[model samples]
Structures are given as C-alpha cells and as structure tokens.
Target: MEQELFTAQDLEELQRRGISLEEATQQVEDIRQGFPYLEILASASLEDGIISNEPSQEERYMSLWERYLERKDASVYKMVPASGAASRMFKMLFSFLDADYSEPRTEAERRFFDELHHFAFYELLNEACLRNHWKSIPKLLAQGDYKAVVETLLLPKGLGYGSKPKGLLLFHRYDKVERTALEEHFVEGALYARDSLGQVHLHFTISPEHQRDFESLVARVKDCYEEHYSVRYLVSFSQQEPATDTLALTPEGGLFRREDGSLLFRPGGHGSLIRNLNALDADIVFIKNIDNVVLDLYKGPTVMYKKYLGGVLVAIRDQVFGYLRQLDKGKVSHSQLEEMSAFMRDAFGIRLPEVLDDESLAPWLREKLNRPIRVCGMVRNEGEPGGGPFVIRETDGSSSLQILESSQINMADEGQRQFFEAGQYFNPVDLVCSLRDWQGKPFDLERYVNPKTAFIAHKSQVGRELLALERPGLWNGAMHDWNTAFVEVPLETFNPVKEVNDLLRPEHQA
Candidate 1:
C-alpha cells in the first residue's frame, strides 16, 4: 500500500533528503489525524507559575552570572534564528506597488511617507532612487509619483529589501552610521554575552541561498565592531538541513503536489533548529529572535535583563546538579527526598502525582532533576499576538510549566479558552539555556522534545490548499521536557520590528 502511494522518483528524492520511509509515513499519519490539543490545566500567573523576582534577588542573580562568566572554562554563545525573507515586513509597501491609486491611502502607507526621512534606510533608498530612475525621492515626490519611490525600495531595480532577510536590512541610525539588525546583534553580544577572555560568541541560523550575502555582510562589518568594542567576535551560521523538512499533505492523507507534478515539502519551522543548536559547543546559549533588537542607546535594560536571566539559570542549575549527585549516591533519606520535591516545586513549578510514594519518588526525582534547564524571560501581556505561559497537564498525570501557542490549545473548549485568555504574561522569545548535564557532558537534546505537539499549517502552492506539518516550536515543544522557569522582564527590553512602520515606534526610536 505504501509502495503504491510513493513512486520510485518520490522515494529517491526522500532518500536524498535523509528522510526515512517510516518517518515520512508517520508525518503523513500525524497530518491526517491532526495533533491533539495540549491539556492545559491552568494559566500561569504571578500567584502560581510566573516568577517576579525582587530587586535583591535580581542583583544576586546578576552577580552570580558574572562570577560564572569569570570561570576560566566558560563558553557562552547567543543563537539568533534569522532565516526567511523580509517580505512580510514590506506587505503594506507591496500593496502600495499594485494599488490603483498610489498616494498613501492606508494609515500605514501614510506613515511610511510622512516619516520617510526618519527611516534609517532613507539615505540609501534615495541613492537607489537616483540610480534607478535618475531622480531623487523628493524630486519624484514633488511630481506626486509615490509609486516610483515604493518601487525603488522593494523591487530588484532598487534596494530589493522586499526579498532580503531582516538581518541584512538597515534597522537603526546613529551619529556615525546606520546598523542592520545583524550589526545590532554584534553590538548586543559584546554587551552581555562576552566572556572574561574578551571573546563574544554568536551563531545565526540562515537560509542556504542567502548564506553568501550574510557572510559578505559579516566580513565587511565584523572587523569594525571588533575594533570599536575592543573585543574579538566569534560567529557561525547554519542552514536547516533537508532532513528537517516535512511533506505537505491533504486533509485525507493524500500527498500534495506542485504545479510541475512533483511532491511538495516545507521547512519544519524553527523547532527544526534543535539539531543545529545541539551541534553548538557552548556551555550557555542565549536564544533570541533576529528582529528583536534596538539601538545601542536603548540597550541598557536589555543587557541588564539578559544577565539576570543567565544568573537565574546558573543558580538553579548548580542546585539541581548538587541534588542529582546526592541521589546518584543512593540511600537518600526520606526527608532529603521530600526536600528535593519541595525545591522542585518552588524552583520549576513541577508537581508530581500524589500517588507516587517515597519509593517511587526517588527514581522520579532523579529522572526529573537530570534534564536540561532553560530560563525564559517573559513580559506583561499587552495585547500582543502570540502565546503565553500555562501549567499544562503532561501525559504522566504530572503538571509542568510550558509556553503554549494558541494552535496547540482546544480553543473551542470553554474551560481551556478561559484559562488561555486569563494569561497575564507573554513570551518574548528571550531565553537562557543550559544544555549540559550535571557531569558537564552535553545531553541528547532531541530526546526532550514532545513530538505530539507539532502544528499543521494551512498553506497554498499554485493556489491549491494543503496542510504542512511544522515540528514543535523550539521554545514551545522542542524544549518541553526541559526544566523551565519564567522571569518577568521589563517591556522596554522587547523591541521587535515586525512591520516597517513598527520601526517608527518609540521603542525602536533611539
């Protein structure tokens, strides 16, 4: 039956992409059956799951993080997930290009032209305008030719920003020059992730087709940042491997084909970066989005919060390791086991099933305490369009704190819907992770993922609709089994440039 579904050429392509037959079959089945909604027990709030540390606790954590950095063997790195094009950021401008009348009709369109000179890329766009149309932006605007300027900014004939990644686009302006989002990361790494050895490390996950452009940009700017900051920069990049791509399927489990009659596959979302992250050789890894950056003038709060999260992770990690070492020696007293369970509750919001008595608790505690640790920085929810923290019911009848996307919930259920809506904080993709085990050896990062949490997206190829399975999100389910903690970070620390006009927000303005 499987042979009848996949032709010889289909099998050959699958082989080339490192996908096993069973894996492909399972993906089809998962897509057909659809993922089950996570059983959310309650929303995470300050009274239960989220942690709001006092100033004294914040200071102690920051100091502990500094001491950890001072260790001679420390290897800290920042991971920025920066793949895909920036076309979404230019959606409004793209519409303007095809509009019947082109004098900034929409509010967003008006804002773009009204604040044209305020954009960091204004000078560059003007230069492109002269080269492309032999007319400056003001000259063209004087003639009521707004489409000309929009064309020059997005089309290949101009700056071609509509096709480029956000990392390479100019994001902020300064006294000396403008900086791309990638350059801002270089500046940020120097501020917080730099080690005592004066080396700042960063890793970017980029698309293979844009690898050369990103490398060239890095080559041209790396030396200047090194000179300015007086710190050496170590950077690396990786593309999502073909093995991580999932096959698209119809709701009935039939394969979806492209216009040319070949099977269609899509990259399995950012969760697939777990493999790239597992390959990294850092003791401490900071995960952040590529567009969530600000100018140097607004970086103090961000720097302070990053250090605080790191300190929190290291402190908890040390205690976890110590308790695991004790459990390893065996003969743990009943009181010691109870203390461990209580600490687990206080530290991670983990609650074991009451049915497990002293005998069962030892092994359970060992299994729970020995996993990886991640400290997630969350901000107060202010009507953002993303997931929030929740205490979800795990398969084993225990409860764990997880950052859940709306798609993972059964929104139709009134109880779950209310719990989700009641959430007061939002995850900002700010994280500090410890990937090593108690003995300093790297854990098998793949073993911790909750494969049942994958998301099936509705997409189109050649105007035909199909469902594409995205692996569990990196922070959402990819790290589901890791010991997770949440810290309330200042909203000032999150300044993501989702749309072109968003850059005009005060957070993005220096």
Candidate 2:
C-alpha cells in the first residue's frame, strides 16, 4: 500500500499550531512509517461478534496455581513512569501561596494547605527553605521573595514541578505519612519483598530536568525502607523528554510549557510507556501508573490479584513454549502446526478467541477452547476506570482481547452498542507475565503485543469562550489494536485523588 505523503498545506497547518517546520517534518516522517498498519486496521470489521462469556477451566486455574507454587523464587520487576509535572496539584497550592493573608484565605484553600503542610509537602518545603529558616510565611513573603517562598514552601526540596518531575511531588496523604508517590511505590516493592529476592526491581523513568530530584527521591525512599522494611532500594531512573504536544493553559489562565516547546500536560497516555518497557533489561516487568497505588490496608488483595494474574501467565507460557518446542522439532502434524501458529497470533495480538457460533471458518485442530479473563473481585465496586475488554476483529481477519476505550467505539454502530452492553469490564491495574518456565526459555513481549492499530491524535483548541486552548489526547482519534482485556479489582484498591474534594474522602486522606 502506498503511504500518504503529508501535503504542504498540512505542514503549514502544523507550523501554525506552533509545531516547528523541522519537528513537523520529523512527525510526518514518523507517521508515514507507522501508517501502513493503520490502513489495514481501517479496513477491518467487528460485525455480529459475541463477547466471550466462558469461565476459565478449573484445570487451567489449577495449572496456574501449580506454576505459581513452583516458581515462588522467581523475581518480578515493577516499573513506574513518574516524570510528570505536579502542575495540577501545585496550581491549587499556588492559590494558597498567593492568597490575601491579611484578610485570610478561603476556608477551602486553608483546609487544603493545612493538609498539604501536615502532609510531607511541607517538610519538602522546610528542607528547601532551610537556608532561609522560614519560621513564618509572612516573614518569607515580607522579604518580597516570591520565588524563594515558592521554592522553600511549595516546591519539593530538590525538585520544581514542571521544572522538576511529577514523581517527586511531596506526596503524603497526611501529616504523619512520610512517603511521597515515589516512596509509596518503593514501599509496595518492599512489601512484595522485591528487593530481597532480586526477583523484583523498582525502576522509575524521569525527564532530564528532574534527574537530580529523581535521585534524591530514590535516596529518601531507600533510607525509609531500609530502616523500616529492611529492604534495599533497587530504584533506577531513565531520562526521556516529555512529549512535546502535552501542554495546556494553567487554571490561573496562562499557558505552561517546558524548556522544550512541549506543553505541561498529562503523560500522553500510558501507551507511550511501551517503548520504555521494551528497552528494559528485566526478564519480568510489571507496568503501572504512578498514581494507581492503593493505601496499605488494600495492598494485600491487590497483590494477591497481581500474583494470580502472573500465575496465569506462567501457566500459559509453559503451554506456548511446549507447542513451540514441538513445532521446532517437526514433531507436530500439519493440523497441529496450523493450530500452533494461530495460537501464537492470538496470544500476542491479545485477540478474543473465536466464538463457536460465529460463521468464521474453524481450524481443524483447536488446541484450546475460549475462556473469560478477569480480575476476580471479592466485593462489588464503583464504576471501572480503564478500558473494558472486548472482542474486536483485526485487519488480518482475526480477533483478540482489546482494552476498549469508549473513544475507540463508533457509537453510531448497533453491533458496537450491543457488544458494549453485554460485557463485564475491568481496569488495567498490575499485570503478570512469567519470565521463564521449567525449561528456562524467555517470554517474548512481542508474542503478546497487538501490532495492528496505532493512534493519530487530533490537536485542536476547543472552548466555550475566546480563550485559546490546546487539546492533545488519545480519545476518539487514538487508534488502538483490538486485543484488550479489563479485569476488575476491589473498590478499596482504587482511590484516585482527582480533585480537592476527593482528598476529603476518608479513603484518600485517612
């Protein structure tokens, strides 16, 4: 298929949108290179598809448990990408810092800052302001030193938000808590005993601007864990530039940008973490977001589910490796060979298994039947956060488990409507995959990756008034391959502090 060449008009439009001609040209080149698969994806259909409702076979679960028992010594690596700006959180802090102290700040602002000061954010400020010995905010502000006051009071000691990194946000839920988000992640690693077995390592990816803060956060976390958990830190940080187009106007109504022409915005979807995950040298890696940590009370069930998922992967790996071995030895029949190849595609593409009633042609040698994938819940929960699991047809006329973002669904279609209505959905929390089997063959991420669809985000400025806007996200325009799965964890495990009101909830502040 011929690649679509970017027209001069398109380039001009990008430049008008603040993308330089040089960068625009590079983006065009990248798109051209990644476009062929998208064309193939565009031609596919998911009509008359039925979601898989079958339960996992008892034997399969037992086999998974068995593998978990045997490989109790195997290590697990956790990677949290923490290089985001706390601009959103700090914007609220700025409201406190810039308040009319003589008249008194609003109750809402006072309460938030009270919690912020009680939480580790204040200690971070104390450390930063040590030279000035800021006994009082009035004293610091009296000197007409707004930057120093901000640096001392608001900024974490070594890191500046946007100027530093998001992971270093002085993230304590309460005054008594000394852990930041970075520390919390390490704490989980320690709880999992990741460092002890050398089986689990915690790695953080940060931008170059925040490298020192990243190191400092690592050191602090190491110190805390060593004294408390007897766990050494396996923490490491990788430096990468934040995506350039992720900027937006601050709530105070001014544009925020990094030194690199990039907008200070949310990490461009966790999908961007794929490249970094691929670059890691670990045998087994668990990819998760920075803010997804549950409080210590909820950690047990969450970790159990994580282990269950990993156990399943270990069992599946053995089966796949056995089949591969047979294929390599030429010991498989023609029918078996075809079946093995089909499984390889389905496993990697994460495609939904074929339904028996579907009109699609059935292969002669089906090694395994379809089963439902889920994060088994011990309790009913609130609404699911991440994309749901769906059976989606790919460009190659095959189907797999696709994490369904509502943006990916064309709501105009009736089939999609029914499909959406019928299935149980779960958030993509921590996932499990085995590094090696009894025979010691490595697990291939490419084997489980869906390579069909990629995204082309539309950058636009939409608003209700004359204010300028920037919206760059993977919503409707983000094209993802269909093999996705959603497994619901417990409600206690999902506490996201999206707004100041959210912190007031006992689950977060408590």
Candidate 3:
C-alpha cells in the first residue's frame, strides 16, 4: 500500500520546487504542533540592551564610518524591502467606496476628503480624474461628488494607486517636483551608502509584477541623481522565491486545496528575504523598509545616525577581527580569554556559556567571533504598531538581543505581559550589517536562523479561513544567533508611513 497523504505527483511537484519530502513532512508536523510563543524574560532597556551614545562618542563613530567608507576594499550596499502594496494604506478610502450612504459617515473618512488636496498625489489624482471621467477634481468637489475623485484616484480607470506598490506612490511633494518612496531611498543611498569610488549600490526586493515598473523608474531617475550628487548608481532588483512559499492548511489542519483540487501556497512574509540578503555579494549591507523615509529638511539626523551605526559596526568588526587573529595563533593567556569574554558580553550582549579549561577557550572564541554581525538602530516607542526589542534566552541557554513582534509574546501570562507592555524601545528596521568574516569570506547566513521562530498567521483565501506559515522575520528569527547590538536612535530617525494619513505628519511634508 502506498501513502495517500502525498501522491507521486505531489512528490514530483515538491522536488521541482526544491522542497524535499522530509521538509514537507516537517512543515506538516509544524502545522500540527503549532508555533510556540516566545518566552519574555525581560524587556531590553537603556540600562541593559540599548546603546545610548554621547556627542563625543557619536563623533568618533562618524569618523570611523567615514574611514571605513574610504577603505579601498570596502563594498557597501543598501537593501530595501519594497514589495507591499498600498491597499492597506487606503483601507478607509476603500470602505468609503463601499458605504451605503452618499457621504462619509466616520471622522477619519471625512478628514481624508477634507484634506485630500494636501496629499502628494493630489495633482496626479486630479489629472487622472480629468482624463478618465472627463471632469476636473475641483468641479467634482463643487458638486459634492467626492466619490468620483476618489474613484478616479484608486480605481483602474484612473491612477489605480490602491493596487500599486507603496514604493512607487508619490509620498512627498516639493516646489519643483513630487517624489516617490523609491526616489527618496535613492537620494538617501547617495548621501550615506556611497563607497570609495563615488558609487552607490542598492538592491530592492520588489514584487515580480512590479519589477519592470521599478526598473523603469530607476532608469528614469538614476541619471538625475547621479548628476545631482556626482555619483554613479548601481541598482538591482529581486523577487521572493517561489520555493520559499509555504503551504496553506484548512481550518481542520488538513491541506488547503483550490476548487480544482490543487494545493494552495502563499508567499512567506519578509522572513523569506533572508535568502535574498544571503545571496548579495557585499562586505556591508544596510537594511531598511521602503516607507521609513522623511523629507530632505529632516533627513540630516537620519543620515547622520545611519553613518553612526555603520561606524559602530566597523569599529566593533575591527576589534573582533583583531581578537580573531589572536585566537588563530593559539597562544592566548587566561587574562586574555577573560578579556574576550568581557568584550562578548559588552559588545554583543552574550555571556560566554560555561567557561571551560584553557585549551577549549581559543576554539570557542574563534567560533563566536566568526559569525555575521549586525548593529540595529532602535527608537523610543511612542504608541507605534511594530515590534519591540528584547533580551531572549535561546534554546541553547545563551541569551542575545532580539527584535520581537507582539504576536510572538505570551500575553496571557501576566508577568510576561507586564514586561512586554513596559518595553521602552521599538525596532525601526534600521540596520547596518557586516556579512563578511575576518578572513573576508561571506558567512552562511542561513545557519544562524532559529527555525522554531517561524510564525503561523491566520489568513483567509477564496473566502475560506486558513492558516498560513510565514518564515521567521529577517531581523527577528532569521538572524537569531548573529552577534547583535542595539543603538538608541532618535525618533526622527524612524519616520514610517504606515497609513495614508501618516503622510499628513510633519516628517512627510515639505
């Protein structure tokens, strides 16, 4: 008798997608057991996990970063995850489209229409309305036909902005021109990511459907920025790999199937980007989300702090490399081992697991120093809807700095909820990472991941509720064992536009 759980065709399909039968079986097992919630020992604070620097220390880090940029062999790149669509940003507007009443019923919807002219895309929306509906926006507003204006802006007949990626949408307007989030990131890269040869390297993880649009936009604006900044631009794009897509399960834990009896697979979340990041060939990479940008006027602190984080990374890497060289020689004294242990605790927030005899110390130090390093910028939380920073004890009994989402926490536990609510800092997805080892070799990033950290989210497909598995988040579980450091960056450094109304904030304005 053959197994009916997975047929020969199913096995062939799995093999074609680079997924093994055992891996598929394990995924099924994971779905059965469900993901375990993360244990919260305590919230990482200014006193323990977060690094707050004085002005003098800031200057030193900046100088060090500039020196690192000037080094001949150094290669720096910026990676932005720009795959999310703008549908969520316009959720309220969509609701307005569906309302039975002629006018908006809620304060939020009324505010959107009352202040619609202030949006960066207002002119484009007006033009779209005039072109498609043969009616100008001002005329529609005069007649109290606000829905027509919104329809032209969001529907396919007009701008179709509701279906577009957030990166390509106009986010900020200046006297001369309006800029998209993608354009802002290009400007940002020129300011901080340029290397010794006056060249900027950038890679964007975009949806496959929007790759051509992104490429065309890059081509259109690259020359303008290059001329403006006197620097060459090398831009690249990647899509989420289909193989990373996870299987969906029905409400009863059975395999989800389409009407045609085929399996259902959904794109893994941002965690899948770890594979994309691992494939990049660079010494240093700066990772940030697409929407976390600001106007040029307020960009000074953001750019300054970016360099500060990079400088801190380079300084720490230099010391770690030096210590690695000393360990390689195998002539370290007891006091020297103690020094390395102290450095590990102070720099990475990791305590050496059970000190052994002298012979075992050198290998342990080498192993610890050889992994990839990342320095993340954390901002003080102010009622933001994002993950918080924490010190979590791993399965191996080693504790390290981690960025954790609220979903991962066991909110049912009173003590854990207290610590979670008391969290003082939020992860802004601002990171400066060193991917190369002391020997100048790329560290295999996949090895450091904690598979247990994968998330199973509740989602609906084809009007049916189902469970979806998301790979561990890139910063959260994806870099689980990397040497991590957290620096407290200013709130100004963490301006992200989660909703359309967020553009009304001062940071997004000219």
- Which number leads on lDDT? 1
Best-fitting candidate, scored by TM-score:
1
- Residue-level error in angstroms, candidate 1, position 76: 0.7
- Per-candidate TM vs. native? 0.99, 0.63, 0.97
Candidate 3 residues lying further than 4 Å off, grouped into runs, are none
Candidate 2, residues 1-510, lDDT tens digits: the string is: 111333455445445555565654444343334322211122111221222222454345434644554465555577776766666655655665666653325665556544544444555565556556645544554565444555554455533552444455544554366456677777676654353333337878776767876786666557756668765566667754343343233333343344554433433454445445545665455655676665565567556555544555555555665764564455456576556546645453333345432222223122222121222121222465445445555555554444455545665666666655554444444454333433554433333333323333434343311112222112111213212223334456555554433445554444
Greater-TM-score candidate between 1 and 3: 1
Per-model root-mean-square deviation over C-alphas: 1.0, 8.8, 1.5
Each model's lDDT: 0.91, 0.47, 0.88
Clash pairs detected, candidate 3: none
Backbone clashes counted, model 2? 22
- As for TM-score, the candidate ahead, 1 or 2, is 1
As a whole number from 0 to 100, the lDDT of residue 214 in candidate 3 is: 93
Answer with 2 or 3, whichever has the higher TM-score.
3
Weakest lDDT window of 10 consecutive positions for candidate 1: 250-259
**Residue 199 lDDT in candidate 3:** 91
Q: Clashes per prediction?
A: 0, 22, 0
